[model samples]
Target chain A: MNLEILGYSFIQKGLIAGTAIAIICSLMGMFLVLRRYSLFGDALSHMAFGGISLGLFTGIYPLWTAFIVSVLGALGITKLRKSTKISGDAAIAVLLVSGLGIGVLLISATGGFKVDLFSFLFGSILLISTEDMLLILGISSGIIATLVALRKQLLHLTFDEEQAQVSGINTDKLNYVFVVLASITVITSMRLVGILLISALIVLPNITAIMFGKGFKKTIALSVSMSVISVVSGIILSYYLDLAPSGTIVMISVAMLVGTLLFKYVNVLGKSHVIQKLTSEA
Target chain B: MNVLEVSDVSIKYNGHLAVDKINFNVKEGDLLGIVGPNGAGKTTLFKAIIGLQNHSGKIKLFGYDEADYQPLLPLIGYVSQKVSFEPNFPATVSEVVSMGLIPEKKLRKGAVLLKNCGYSWNLLYKKVGKDSDKVLECLKTAGLESLKDRRIGDLSGGELQRVFIAKALVKDPVLLILDEPVTGVDADAQNKFYTVLRKINTENKITIVWSSHDLEAISKLANRVACMNRKLFFHGEKEEFFSNKELLKTYAESAMQMHMHDHN
Candidate 1:
């Protein structure tokens, strides 16, 4: 193992930012995927790209603009799905394409900094600065704290929304909170995983951990551990192999999901064989 | 005083009237069974009482105005008819029960609401299933104490229904609203479930309002009955519900209509 990379400040910053992102993504993503809103995160990430380009064009802070645009975009998606005849996935796709189109138009209008914009699209995890690190830490802490406080309510809502509302929970208001949190999670983690791959960080760890059949809290714990492992290992491998960190991280996540599926299959096969053997022996 | 009062309540969905000007009152400790054919708006009435649907008429809960019942929402527990989820929601029996005790706030108010629901400040910060007396009592009352650690998806239909009942009971609710509480349970299990509910009514004095298609079982248990088919056809004591020729005729005709509609 090339352990000497820890000496580099950029590596340290990348690790910190990656860890923060991994925690938030896994936690928030569990609820999203379970609610069948995985594409909502994807759409928000694309919208954040538009926000980033708008900020760059207007000469302001991109993260702030991305945060605002992503939140509004999420609300718009929610409203469109609720009010319009368009399907939920269709609504998401519409926003996704519009966002990408706007982002491209802005980039072309600016006519320079194509390299800088591409970094946001594909990510530049190794180039994380102290300011970026601080933003990640602050946003991650806020998201985690809010989730912890609303843990039981969120569980109730996720498990059975109608029951939650019937039990006097203000589900409409809670929904807004979920949208805002998801938007924040997508936008803040974009730098670590890139616009294209952010949803993978939010979704894959949760998909894998749910296969373990652990209870909700245990699933969340396992997902966070899995996400952090994939992120850290991917960063280290990328550093050594001179690969794209975002691509490497997403690939590692996909690998972990496949591994869990295979293990589940083998475990089922092993159990059935044991049962058959016992029956034959008897 | 009546535990619940619904006056001239009507519900419209997409310009179609589902429940029309229905009126009823439930006395405290009454096991009120609402019986109706399919699409007869029984569930809609329950939703109206739980404040889940918009209605034109007034609903009074324990003397609180309809709009003012938000603060008292914790006092009413509702079990849904449709138990739909991912089937991998990662929740245990006790965890689902704990959600009932989570208080209602406009946003992110789970902890604050839990504290207001009589949980001590210290207990609010602790992990779920810290063996609180209220949770244990509700579980024991609902016969789910033995399955507190069981994942919700792994439970049998009867046991799963009890878990939901336990979740509702944990709040010490004044009214327990159940929509088709025994839809998928076996016949034997349904009888046992009714027995448990009867005991809960007698021992805990929790007012129960349940919707069901099983008229015989409901008439056997419920002291009051509300018969409906898009409107209130009858509302009175169970004896009157059984003896009223006009009411019986209406129910029979509605049942025939439903059977024909299904075939068509």
Candidate 2:
């Protein structure tokens, strides 16, 4: 309610970055969720933790290392799933566990969970540096642009991968590109909700949107709106309540999901109940 | 005119030969039914033809060589076995069918895409109006015009098959390849599906090379039949395939083996 909060540059940056990442993650999440890789963001974010730890241990920029490790890790998961011998679910679990395992080991090596580790683990969106803001803006735009460009191909591939390939799509390349983009989205989203809960930002709104039983594009539209609303409101509330921005954002997302589910089932139950009563009267 | 030519095609799958040294040619407008029991490599052969699986062979489409099936893709429409995607994929019938046009529009008419929308995804969404009539025509052919706006998941297996068939037809492809499309469909849906398949073959004159478990359906529709159990059993006139008692026995044996495997 305080208009004075808008005057703080850090608050403005956090809100902008949060909204941007939400849009990117929600859009990316829609495609992944449809493809049945709903936890891919979660897996990649865990790898990003390991990636950041490696960066910190090696004295490299943590975000750059996070990007590198996450991309490679995502590609590995994709390759594993494609091999047929290894199931996609197993591949996801492997990467998810490996990332967290390595991250923990490296954290211990770095002499426990310091302020740096905690900052990335839970995020510091409210204190986003200008460079981080620029990075978020750049990454968000690039991701959105690429997704829109490949929309049809992605749609066809998502709907039916074999059919997409037979359509002369270099599906292999497209898939790799897709995973890379997903990795970028996961890594970029880390600043918003950190490694621990970035997947919530990526997947929650999309899941909620699906509960509406809308078409794919409509689902995406609904998801984006829900995500933006959650991010914007979560940020404002976080400022006023003196809570963590990331937790507030994800909490709002969880609230939206529960609310949508309630509305959906109640409407369904009400309709079916009416039908049952009418039949009994007849 | 040979619509499809496969020479010395062989596939090594899971450390064994799934399809071995297969050779066949499908002439223009020919309805060729590929029949085999489960694991007979009928699906494998289809996958090879459609470039889904790796194989060592020579494949020519429209007289063009293999490894460059890129140019020939727009001329071919492929529907794989069982589809088996998440039932909740969220694509409506029309949106999926409209996607069939993307390969054609991207491959054959690049300039139209450039002019319409710089970003091809926007172009697809924007060009939906332009392709609506065409999408409907394909749907009509598949008897799915009624389900145009329905979410594909809401449809039954038969209806879903028809949706994919409709999606394939949106390209107005010269070659239509379907793998076990009517399997798991009920008798009534099967009949309706056959009716659409017959219309496309006889009226539209689309060259179809399909793999199916239904030999009876193949006998009724396909002019040519290829019976296989890894290696080609017979590739000739449908009458020859049916009338040969010895060959029929071998085919029956493979079918029997499939049943055994299923039970196991």
Candidate 3:
């Protein structure tokens, strides 16, 4: 091993951002995915794509636009679901298409898809500036800390909204808080997988951790650990293999999910074999 | 004070009346068992009272505003008709019960990023175990102390039902609302469940509005009876509600019609 990549400033920044994002994504994504709202994150990221497009078109800081657009779009889903007869997933679909549509139109309006927008579409982990990474770090810390404080309420609402509400928890407020955190998570994850694959950060790690069938807190801990490892390993491998960081990160996370499922299958197989042998002997 | 006051409350589904002009009230310390057949709007009525379902008219809980249930939440604990969730979601029995004790007022705090900075972590994770005496006592009441550490998904339906009851009971609310809470429970457990309910109603004076299909349980346990078939068919003393053969016959026929309509 050359061990030379560790000295690079970009690699250090990527590592810091990757680890922070992994923790926040796993924490918030667990709640969203479990509630069947994982796709809501995907849709919000699309909305962020539109924001990024608008920023690139207007010559403004795209992160600010992405933050504003995605947060507003995320809240729109909640409001639409609450105020109308439409389902949450249906509301998400409306935003997803509208975001993607507006994004393409904006790119065309700005004289077609520019190279600047593609970096955000596919992520540019190696190209992170000090300013960008600092903002990401600040927002990521805020999201993680907020998640920690609202931990039990999130789980309570996730488990049973009616029970939580009757217990005197204002569930709608917790829901808004959850969506805002999820939106911010999508916004900061731009440098990791950009707009297209951002939900992977939230969903893949959680599915992998859920395979272990651990209890609630343990399941979250396992997800964060898995996500951090995948990100760290992906970045290191991308450096040595000359691969795309965003693609590499998502591929590694999916590979972990497969690996966990395989492990559980083999464990079940081994237990069954032992039982078969015992019955034969009897 | 009346623990719950429902006046001229009506609920509609797709422009058809589900609960029409239902009027009733429960004084503090009263244990009211509401019994009605399928599609009789018992569940709908409960949902309206809790502000879950949209309805017309007024529902005043603990002297709070009509229809708005936020302030009354701290004083109320409820078990909905559908008491379940994502099976694989990681929640333990004790943790589920401890959720009830998370002060309703504390939970109503702002959800802004830095607004809940003073939120206590210990109140959530540390106390969410067998360590909390209230959780243990509630679990004990439900005969589920041994299952406190088990994953809720790993439990039987009956056990899961008790876990929810423990969650509802852990807070010791002024008003306890349960809708068919003992559906999957065995007879012995059901007997014990009612016994605990009776004790709480008499000793703690926790006003209860329990809806059930089991007329036997309601007849034995309820001091007040309410029979519904899309409307308030009867709301008075249990003896008056049960002894009136003409009223019972009318409700029975309406229930049969509703049951047949459901099948159709």
Candidate 4:
């Protein structure tokens, strides 16, 4: 392992971008998983891809376009779900397929077929520019600040919407804000993790954290820790094995989830013994 | 003066009229029990009052229009039939109870309300306390003090129901609305639950409006009763409401036929 390579400019940028995406995605993922909106995150990521493709065809900044499109997609899905009997999963399925279809159509129509969409499908940490890095930092910090300020309201909405509303927490407005925040997270993470695989970063770390987390705040903290560990480890492994950084990062997250599940199983088994002993004594 | 007044309120769901032209007045400190069979629009009425559903006509709570009560929501506490909480939702009992205070206090000040609910400020400040004093107080009120530290998912159906009621009670609302609060619970638990509810009404002077299908429970517990089947059939003193021949006929017909078939 060349210790100096870790300090190189490109590697440093990749690490910062990777860490920022991990933090934001994982934090948002905690709420998403709790609310059973994991598929919404997946659908929004695909929508961002469609936006990116459109931006590519028009020769504009894909990030801005992707952010706007994903937010619109989130709003559209929410409205559709509310006004119709369509299940959330069904709605996401529709959005995902249509978004992918549009992306493919636009890419081919613009004669950008040879533009290597595979890079966006997987990811290329080496391609992250300083501008993209700054966007990631700004988004990550904004998300953290908003969450901290609205922690009480967010926690209320997440746990019980009706009760939260009865207690004067504007659940509808908060839900809209939550969806928009999720859109930002998906768009910000698209550079490091790619639109196709962005939700993996958003969901897997949070799911892993939940197994060991004692409460909502702790779950968020653990999720950020897990995300950072996975991204850094994945990037390091990718450097050594010559693999895609995003794939390696997702693989690391899956490993962490599996590890946490095993640890939880052992803990539960140990507690059952004590419970049995107490029951017998009683 | 009436604490709550609903006049000719109707609710339509996708072109179907769930509740139609219902009128009622709930006096201050009234323990109003709403009883009707399934699909009788009892829950819809509750939802309409809370602004969870759109309805025509008018509703007033504490002399203010329902529309104006958005800011006064903290004065009203509601427990719905749907208990839909995340099974592994991360929060201690005390933290969950403290959520009831979000309307009354800012994040930091809400911690003080949490302590007032019976949790120790010191223990709450720590990672997780062993069911704070405030949490235990709520549990004791709901008759689940022993299960304070247990996760909401780990509770039995009856205990979970009580926990929801406890959550509502911690807010100390002037008006408490419960939609089928005792459904799916054992007879003993139901009895105990009603006793707790009666004590809260009589001792603490909290106003309550609960919906239930148990006529006997309603008769025994309610000072006032409202009967509804898409429209208000009766809304007055429980004795007068139950004694009305037409109202009794509506409720008794099904039960009477079931009894006749059983005897045959």
Leading candidate by lDDT: 2
What are the interface RMSDs of all the models?
2.0, 1.5, 1.8, 2.2
DockQ of each: 0.56, 0.56, 0.52, 0.47
Arrange candidates by DockQ, highest first: which order?
1, 2, 3, 4
The reply for model 1, stretches above 4 Å from the true place, is: B104-132
Q: What clash pairs does model 4 have?
A: B117-B134, B118-B133, B118-B134, B119-B134
Please state the Cα-based DockQ of model 2 relative to the true two-chain complex: 0.56
Estimate TM-scores for all models.
Answer: 0.92, 0.91, 0.89, 0.86
TM-score of 1: 0.92
Question: How well does candidate 3 reproduce the true complex, by DockQ?
Answer: 0.52
Please say which candidate is ahead in TM-score: 1 or 4: 1
Task: Residues A79-112, candidate 2: write the lDDT tens digits.
Answer: 8778766877788899999999988899889888
- Report how far residue A158 has shifted in candidate 3, in Å: 1.9
Off by more than 4 A, model 4: A1-4, A114-116, A265-282, B105-140, B144-146, B241-249, B254-264
How far out, in Å, is residue A28 in model 4? 0.7
Better of 1 and 4 by DockQ: 1
Candidate 3 local lDDT, A142-251, one digit each (tens): 98888888887888899888777766677899888888888888888878878888888889999888877777888889999989998899899999999998889999
Q: Which parts of model 3 have CA positions greater than 4 angstroms off? A: A278-282, B53-58, B62-70, B104-131, B184-199, B202-205
**Relative to the true structure, how large is the alpha-carbon lDDT of every model?**
0.84, 0.85, 0.81, 0.78
Query: Model 3's CAPRI class?
Result: medium
| lDDT digits (tens) for residues B133-243 of candidate 1 | 667777888877888887888987887888888888776676889889898789988887888799778877778998988888887889999998889988989999998
TM-score of chain A of 4: 0.91
